[model samples]
Target: MVYIAGEEMTHYATELFVDQWIKPYFDISTWETYDLSCKSRDVTDDKVLHDAVEAGARIGAIFKEPTITPSTVQVKEMGLSKAFGSPNGAMRKGWNGITISRDTIHIKGIELGYKNQVLFERHAVGGEYGAGYNEVGAGTLLTTYLPDDNSPPFVVDKRDLTDDNNVVVVYHNPYDNVKELAHIFFGRCLEHKVTPYIVTKKTVFKWQEGFWSTMKEIFEKDYKDTFLKEGLLERSGNELTHLISDAATMQLIRWTDGGFGMAAHNYDGDMLTDQIAQVHRSPGFITSNLVGKSDDGSLIKEFEASHGTVSDLWNDHLAGKETSLNPLGLVEAMIGAMQHAAMLDVEKHPDDASKLEVKMKVLNFTETLREAMHNTFRYGQGTRDMSGPSGFSTEDFIGKVAWRLNR
Candidate 1:
């Protein structure tokens, strides 16, 4: 397995996150790592992203700390060759990944933490994020694709503009990629044993209608029977109904019994997942994992915290001030990668008792890791951001987890 440490406070926090898990469970130095830090990404021209993605597919799993996606200002300040694209975006394309699984944190006996549910956002191949565009003064733009020597250019969109109007054209293909995303969505819902809802804005964007349509067909044609056999859909609609993206947003906020699973297009997923994070608690409460299965039978998986690189926390750290940054999302991602690695091993050697034993160990460790994080809350202790009875610094918080696991 590989773990990538991104820039900023995450740059530092990820080190501790990794330390907390590996020292107790396995040889700390045995884990493979690549620095996807901003400076590193610039220096290496994002070669690390490719290396990490390739490693994830080959090794079956990767865990990552958040990286700062650079803007023009950041590019100049860092003195980079060029503004690097999102490391997350590059990894997604490299692996043909589906949506990152978003789940809320739940703290027991406390009415606060959000319920656990999966947000299955469509991600792969194309979207607004990866599109390249340049500012234009005045010109007519045409989109074209030519198949071969005998073919003519097939134009998609053409527009003419005056000097007063500035425009950009970027294209994204949600065609073939949507199928993989849909399969993953339905499969994950079944795995989690929850009603699954696919949300889309069919009215606004007819193309996105394809997402809802294709997903519906796949679920009914392939997964419905199995879902019924498992007795998974409790609602009258079997929880497989389509909701307008708008309505789905409301339900996410309204549902009390933990709105089990939801699938959305990439943009909707990005927006709604963050909203869930904020309402549920901090963004730290959310956990994410990106995955895809190749035709070659390899599962390419990348696990990461849902939140961004904590720039503010990085500032505090740089100032040599003790900060209480929440690394919950990052730590949870590591746990996911570990458990997935164990599961894959068990699948390979089903009859091997040693493999089963290791799987159990990883699982037990996952439980302890989670409990340790919550244990702080149970004991009226936490980071300053958590506003607990007494706050602990980042090191102290990790120490608490280590202490609990050992004790």
Candidate 2:
């Protein structure tokens, strides 16, 4: 497994949780570790980021701490090299990523905003995140796609710019990987027994029609029969469905008990999943896992918390003030990574009895710890964020979970 560390208070919390929660039961000495702090990236010229992504691809399981993508202001404050881009894009591309899955974390006996699980699969590449744009005076704007075979270059878009202040942005959705994404997304819905939906703005943007059409074609050919047999279609009016991005947004709020899965193009998915995270009470109550394929077609996965580095809490901690930062997201992400590593081990060594035993031990430990954490919150003992003002402090919450585990 690969463990990539980050900056800020989240990094501090990660070290504390791993020391108190994981080290006592698990031996992680063999895990590959990388420091991806802002200072470290500046010192290493961001080579450490690339190296970490490569190691994650090689190892197949990664647990990453949320890191900062320094803006111009942050770059000056940090007092080091140029502003670095987010490591997420590089990591996803390096791993040949298909979809990024974010699901609500349902803790029993705790009533969150949602009563059921809402799973979101975001197409991991090729949209506005990589778009090219430029501002110019009045002129004709032309975009073309050149075929590598040199048959001809075709115009993608052509528009006359009438205003002096105008910006033209262009991007493409890669259809080649949509088939792979469909397989993963629908397959996930079937596995979780949730109704599947594909969201797009085909009516408004004709270019987005390609994405919707591709997903529909793949779903009809590959997953329709299985979904029907599993009674998943019953949840969506007896057929697989497509929802416009706007409609999907409204439905998310109306369907409080979420027994559905949704897949959207990169930008829409990015925005919609944030809403899902909020509906689940907080980003702290969600787990993010990027699922991809390796060069050999094996599975590659990286897990992390759905939230940011919580810089505000870090500042408070720095001032020697008591902070009650919630660590649920990070804790769950670590458990997920450990579980994935154990499963991969079992898959690679199916006939090895020792490997199977080790996998079981990991399962038992994760289950026990998960229940302990949940019980701590259920019984009115957690950080002030989850519980009330009378709730435990950050360290106290962890100590409570530890106490439960020891018993």
CA-only RMSD, every prediction: 2.8, 1.5
Which lDDT tens digits does candidate 2 get at residues 1-407? Answer: 89999989889988988888889888999889999998999999999998998898888999999999999999999997899999998998899888888888888978887887788889998899889999899989988889999988999779999999998888877778888888888888888888999899988977888887888898889888898888889978877788999999999888888889999999999899888887777788888899988887788999999899999989999999888877888988888888888888888888999988988998999999899988888998977867778888778888888878888
Best by the lDDT measure: 2
For model 1 the local lDDT of residue 200 reads: 80
lDDT of 1: 0.76
The digit string of per-residue lDDT tens for model 1 on 127-163 reads 6666668788787888887778967778878888777
Total backbone clashes of candidate 2, pairs 3 or more residues apart or in separate chains: 0
Best by TM-score: 2
lDDT of 2: 0.88
Clashing pairs in 2: none
